[model samples]
Target: MDDLRTIIDKTLKQYLNAKQTPFKDNQLANYFRREPKQYIESYIKKTGFHFNYDVKSSVGNGRWAIIPWIVLFDTDISNSATNGIYIAYLFAEDMSKVYLSLMQGWTYYYNEFGTKIGQIKINAALNYWRNSLNLTSSTFSTQDIHLIDPSKRYDTSLPRGYELGNIMSIKYDAGQLPTNQKMEDDLSLMIQSLEELKSKLISTKDIDLSNKYVLSRTNIIKNHKRTPTKRDYDQQS
Candidate 1:
């Protein structure tokens, strides 16, 4: 990702300096997504892992996104931030650091089970994944990642969902990124880690993955008032 450091660094500087929201015509903002996305594509291609990537700086067509991101996904697992689990590079709104995270999709649970139950589901999945993935072998963090200020409330809670949904991640300073060798190694491990989740998912019969795949299915997660029993997370499904 050394090649990516230039794009990531310059774009953050430009975004921090922008007097207005970034738009389609904003050459620098657009390049942030357009240019780096190609490097991501080639990088993943080298791993021989089948993944689709999206490098985004803004949402809709009019404004800069609160948090710009690049996601690598398997179509069967997820195609967007709306549902399922995927790996992504998330930029903090304050422009301090970027995180490469194996995170969950919160919207699917909210739409299916409502906010309360949705959160429960997310926690259960987090427990299951954290235990199953055994992230100790990697350099990624198992701690919480902050994307935006916790005090401010937004019209959309997507950013909050991101904060709560992170399972494991690695932080990269915006000003100082890792070398090419370090980045390449991280990518390989990330891809392998995601596959471990996929293997567990294959055992589950019900998953509202993306909007397209699990159109009519419903996922009813285990509900617990306190610490769950061993059986609560014994089955990944």
Candidate 2:
């Protein structure tokens, strides 16, 4: 737990010290992608719970350029390899919103050079999620179709829209319970805080640091020279 706190503190500090550049958003996205598995693992450890979660991403143009979706399930008690508790589903309009909410202290760093590096990271993450879910569909459906009546195979009364191209999915095993709970709680809190901060930023139209909350504590190591102490699985059990 102490190590997890230290890692988060260090990450947050790096985020704060990072210069606010046009492409900082892209940088931030890359930062998370580089250590995604580790980050998620730490989150699980801290939460002291396990769960299964899926994430997906797709790209387009304008506001619809990037989309990310996530679904979470609780770990199954009977089978560690399969089954989980149903958690929540999340859908983000773009990578920026996804990062701002899920990854604290790492937003707007990848918006550099009018490039879509952040979008690429999102797609990669989505791919990871899809692989985890073992989805058979090579291409996702672009239309939203539903039948009004369960007895009828098709419904004529409902309005049908083409499936939006960007979509992804994931599944979790029961063995991942503790860590999953921690991640979910942390992510949920971060999202709520980010929403409030975003609303304030929009209202004030300010980009100054003074206006933002000090979400991270200072004192980050200048040199990335620390070795993480490994936990003993046998001892833990």
Candidate 3:
């Protein structure tokens, strides 16, 4: 895992430098630099110094995008007969970024734990953690959950083959964090709309009906029918 993380971090640095858009805020960058100070503080408080953390940068978008950092902790605390926090980080630039980062994080965890027992344990833990963070969602379909599991075939191990079912069966509560899946979905829609607009602009040689509603409502003098208004041309300009 450490080797994989190092390779990813190196790739990210090269990608960012190639784009010439390093993050603007050094402090924010450092907040995600390795085991973040904030996460360390929280872990210390929760488990009373028995736990330690390992941090790594996972993914990043272009200059205007958010980056994710993963944090894995060793905990002496036990929940459901398993030992320690075993937490993973999905730190990002905002709520929307956090949502995508978490999806990526779950993908990584699922890949790492490929066995039935491992899958059962990790799925339950993930559901509990999300709920504890107040990150439960009605929007997460079974298809979405299946996407995260590398072994697409479901057995008795994963319960209803969704996070909520795993958590409910285990009877564990984590609490709420924050949810931004809706915002992420909305942003995706906006990007798609923009791409469509751009395609239309490229394909059309003339602007004919731009602001047609307003032009149709305007009164024209004389008995002749009005010509198409100049606003169409102006829109092209």
Worst 10 residues of 1 by lDDT: 209-218
lDDT of 2: 0.28
lDDT (Cα atoms) of all candidates against the true structure:
0.68, 0.28, 0.31
Candidate 1's displacement at residue 139, Å, is: 1.3
lDDT of 2 at 144: 24
Model 2 reaches what TM-score against the true structure? 0.22
Candidate 2 lDDT by residue in tens digits, 75-126:
2211111111122222222111121112111122123111243333323332
Sum up the clashes in candidate 1: 0
Residue runs of model 1 more than 4 Å from their true location after superposition: 19-22, 50-60, 134-136, 203-206, 209-237
Clashes of each: 0, 33, 10
lDDT of 3 by residue, 2-56 (tens): 2322323333344334334455554334434543434345434553433233333
| TM-scores vs. true structure, each candidate | 0.79, 0.22, 0.27
Off by over 4 Å in 2: 1-29, 50-65, 69-91, 94-237
